[model samples]
Target chain A: MTEDKFKHEEDLFCSGHRACPGCGAALTSKLVTEATGPQTILSMPTGCMEVTTTPYPESAWGISWIHNIFENSAAVAGGIETAYRSFDKRNKEGYMNHEDVNFVVLAGDGATFDIGIRSLSGMMERGHDVLYICYDNEAYMNTGIQRSSSTPIGAATTTSPAGKESFGEDVHKKDMPSIAAAHGLEYVATASVAYPEDFKKKVEKALEIEGPKYIQIFAPCPRGWRHESKNSIEIARLVVETGLYPIFEMENGKITNVKKLKDRKPVEEYLKVQGRFKHLFEKEGGEEVLEELQKIADSNAEKIGIDKE
Target chain B: MTEDPYEDLKISKGAVVKPRTTLVNKTGSWRSEKPIIDHEKCIACGNCEKFCPDMAVKETEEGKFEIDLEYCKGCGICAEECPVKAIIMEEEEK
Candidate 1:
């Protein structure tokens, strides 16, 4: 590996915010802000990222940011992007050059998949020049690990704890990328903090495109996921390698690229490492539970074509 | 930031905080273990700076890496992801 690959830009998501020790979402925001640069304006909703970074008089962001409500960050961003486009139009009419500005929405799964999907859909359908990034930790991490629509099956969250009658989350994760692609967005991708280079590249690519773009990052939370702090990045990688999370892109409603798994690991390998899924290993009918999860990974691998030959 | 936060201001429509003022907070106190990089074995790949959730690891002008104790949360991610295993997390002393 060359040293050039490791070199990065200034931290737009500055330090001194109060994120938990090994927060994958924090790094996800940091890498995203770095890629977007200082010219960008951010609209963040109520989530772990908002709560951790902005506390009263201090904010970790170096760029201009706005915190609206839990369900309207995308709408706010769309409004701001629309305002910037108006400026572009008037400036062109007057033969003036105005500095380019990008409007981005940094939201979490609860806001994106459940509460704010309507607003997000409106933003995308309106074709606003906004890059909406959803940091999916698979649950409502900010509000004591509640379950959201994006929560994967067989994973225990506070609201979806594994028990005799329940097998953690009963429903499968929402296919958010496909939903975004259905809006005919120019770019839609699913990335992970485990692959930093790809994440940054996708952010840059999404910004370069003029229309609306959606990129959901698989951010792991050590606090909510019940994993070792140091294993945050490791578990993020396992999600991609296990085929539980497929990293792919859709351009103009066509699948452009998929990060094919070299040798896809079993769901057991990923589930065994986290405390949330520990019940799957020790509970009654555990093997059946695992089989259900394995089917999810298999179907994902087939649908996304991660096993390309 | 105003040392007397409430003393200086009129009630305005917006809240004003200077950029990067969070640097004033010495977050290093949050660390139970500190990272000490073995410069002799360091390859300067910059992974520590890149992967640090807190952005505490920085490259000095001398082309050397330094972890800003003021902001390093002692997460030990740098040590964990170090390609060359140059960084070791050492227990902090009272």
Candidate 2:
């Protein structure tokens, strides 16, 4: 039922950037910017994005972009929307008559879930007309793959390095969409770069809504995940097929629909694909870890109503 | 009859806050490590204390923030919020 109504254009993200090969965050950024078109104001935080795209005098962003402190992106974006309104009122009749630009916040998982959560939560609660998208590459990939609250259990990061006495991240990935939905917001959805049509459509839908909207985008981090660039889409597909990252949307705190894969892939197939989970398979009795992960995935699927075909 | 939405806020009703005990330390127990202030790199910006969920970090002599491990969740919010990246989450081996 997937329609190709998407017209892949070239206005926002210019090619030949310094992002690592097969970086999902980069691809998602490109797609998101394109969806919003050139009339967009981006509030980016200090992470892999701010580092890779902008190097001192030169910048990569074509839109009017502001790089705020790591944890204050939502607050900054909210401020930008207000400022735009005031400017348009005094000069061009209130952000309505002129080119209707989208005010968007782009943040990593570290910023969205860990450091900048309060600002994001507050902005969303206040009903700011901004699209808050989280380009989740799992951990804090910008600072060498340190473990953030978004990192899944058994995943290795610089801080949660697998040692003789440790099992990498000890906690499960925090349910961010559920937390966002609990705010009684208009929209909350999950998308991945692997599925561009769905992702683009979701972005479009989010823009059409009046109130605050949130999208937790699953972007693959090749450097942090230790995977080849070509395997990005395949690995992302496995994440959905294994039921780890169920693609679904929540409206008014209730899930309406979920994307179900016809073929259910084993959790091992997903596990062995990423190097971050390499520790889970590199040891004896690794099957136990795999089973535990599968159980978690199954539970998630049940919660989201993702039935196996 | 219209009801107030937050009148039934469960979290603010003096509910007992419990630690994550059911999370079995399959990776062995985490050592209670706290943030040590270098003072040299500390900017006294209060970002660490401002963003700390547990409020375990506090500023002491010379305006440097020190971590109180008792309530610290090892969440590393301080490290992430530190503008200069001064705070590092060091693991204390049990």
Candidate 3:
């Protein structure tokens, strides 16, 4: 239960910030920073999180945070980690200690999957001691809900409207976890805000690892998804329960763990909740798109071997 | 309020002199509604306390939940997710 996960006393993410009501990105950031503790430095790129949390004189983050351009968060984190290592070596007898400082990178899907992939790839290939977290809200939510590479198929957005000619986004969501795994990082995992325990454990585990670690969390956007604010966690849970978003972990290019669904629900149960997919149910020939999406889920289940149990 | 918002930029290249300074900014005016808890019907489930995105709900010394109106954005999430009907959202007073 979520109550069991809230035993910690210090909340690194305090109140009185400007996040929208029931934002999954805000919730995920809270859980992540709480698990990371006080001795951490975060590198955030230009995105919704950076804009909403840090508006001039106010900042929601309690840790040492630096905001960079949209595509260089990974690169900035690498520089920070390198500089900290050098300082730690030079100031062995100094008053300050910088040995156990954690370096993290937080960016949205638009930054990670589309514009910032090159820098991210370079960082992972070099094996920097940085934990990169991409809070996937499925599209460019900060910029008026525009379509991004991470946007799923048959989902409506400002750029990919479901009009007479187009059926929303034509392609599927990019496979980012697998792309990260291909870089042969020490740790890579997928998590959801609905499962706080699992998400916290992954954050803690990533902190323990030595080299580059990547965790992409499935964060739902209420304003962009056109769902009620209170249903954020519920929608996140349904996405996983329907096998649409597989929760898994990898170590050194091999799959180590997968969270299987005991009672898998139909994909329709997950799609019908969000207004982004509302057109699919209303328009003709939309059943084919749903069928295609279901097949993709089934294929994901088969590849992960999650349905065997 | 401080006259110069960029006063900190003169300290160093990228140093954050004052941490957690956001406490000074009062964001309560952003709310359109307010959540009021009925202490008589409260059960201290901690769900409201745990799930508040802003951390506006706190557990009192007597094990009761209290919403900090100064920070609560009237998301109504606490009332919507409350196990019991102890919490209700009323229109914010002008």
Candidate 4:
């Protein structure tokens, strides 16, 4: 019960940001920044985190932060890191010299898996010394809960509503860790907000590596997922336990570790709590979708080795 | 010292020059219900502090914990995750 790994002394991510009451992204930001330290330079894109934390006159970030266009957080970080690398460290007037700071991108899945994939790919391929953290809340949550490429199969959203004629999002969640690992980076990992100790350790590990690294964090949205606000952390844990979100790390294109579910729960324990997956229990063919979703989880457990036994 | 944290940087107009100035927002106003902790039953396991989304649960000088109403958004996460069932959410009186 005493999870001390999540403990940190830094106040880099100050409170009073306008995130929702139980925002997983908000908590994720605090945890990531706690792990990265005060010397970290952050690049964010347009997303719930960017909007909520900057309410015009006030900002929650204590460290240096930059948020430009939607698709180029990684691009900007690459440029900033390149600038930092060439600067004279002895020159006290230099904004920030190399070896003094870690360049990082804190982006949403919409900006990451969809709109910004090209720039992200370019940054990783160019081998920029940076870390990119994607707060994947499953869908384009801030913009009225639109269906994103990262949305899970059978989950209903604004664009992929469940009706008599159609089921929810048909496509599976884009295998983004694999995509990031494909760039030949030293580290690519998946994390959840529920297990913040694991998430924090992953951030620290990614920063220690030389080249570009990607850590996609599962950030559950209370409004988007249609669950009780207080259940945010619990739901995040449930998502992992049900095998819907595999928590693992890849180093040099090989699986290193996986967080196995303490209690392997069925999809219903996870799905029934959220309204987005409500169709899976109500509709006629929804049972089959649940089974199919379970199959995906089983395949993930097999492929990722989340369950060794 | 009342000195601005970002004063040295020449950012443009409307730039946030003060670090953590958002503490003035008092997000506790957003709460429709507030958590009331019964210290008699409190185990002080710090689960509330660990899981607080708003960083509102603070360890008191007595080693027990108390909620900082200034930042608590009344998400009830503390009550939900409380190991001792010491926290009870009470409806706010508007």
For each candidate, the alpha-carbon lDDT, in order, equals 0.87, 0.74, 0.85, 0.87
Name the TM-score of chain A in model 3. 0.95
Model 4 lDDT per residue over A142-200, tens place: 89999999999898999999899667999888999999998998999999988888999
What is candidate 4's CA lDDT for residue A213? 97
Kept native contacts, fraction for each prediction: 0.56, 0.00, 0.48, 0.53
Better of 2 and 3 by DockQ: 3
Error of 2 at A303 (Å): 1.0
DockQ of each: 0.34, 0.01, 0.32, 0.32
In order of DockQ, best first, we have 1, 3, 4, 2
- Which candidate has the highest DockQ of all? 1
Predicted candidate 1 versus true structure: per-residue lDDT over A1-309, tens digit per residue: 225221222457877788899899999989988799888889999999988888879888888899889999999999987776677777646422223676799999999999999999999999888999999999998889999999888889989998888879888888999999999998999999988999999999999998899999998899898998888888888988999998988899888999997799998888888999998899888888799989989998988899857
TM-score of each: 0.91, 0.72, 0.90, 0.91
- Span of ten consecutive residues with least summed lDDT in model 4 chain A: A1-10
A104-206, model 3: which lDDT tens digit per residue?
A: 9989999999989999999999989999999999999998999999999999999999988777999999999999999989899999988878998998999
Q: Kindly indicate the candidate among 2 and 3 with the higher lDDT.
A: 3
Give model 4's TM-score versus the native structure: 0.91
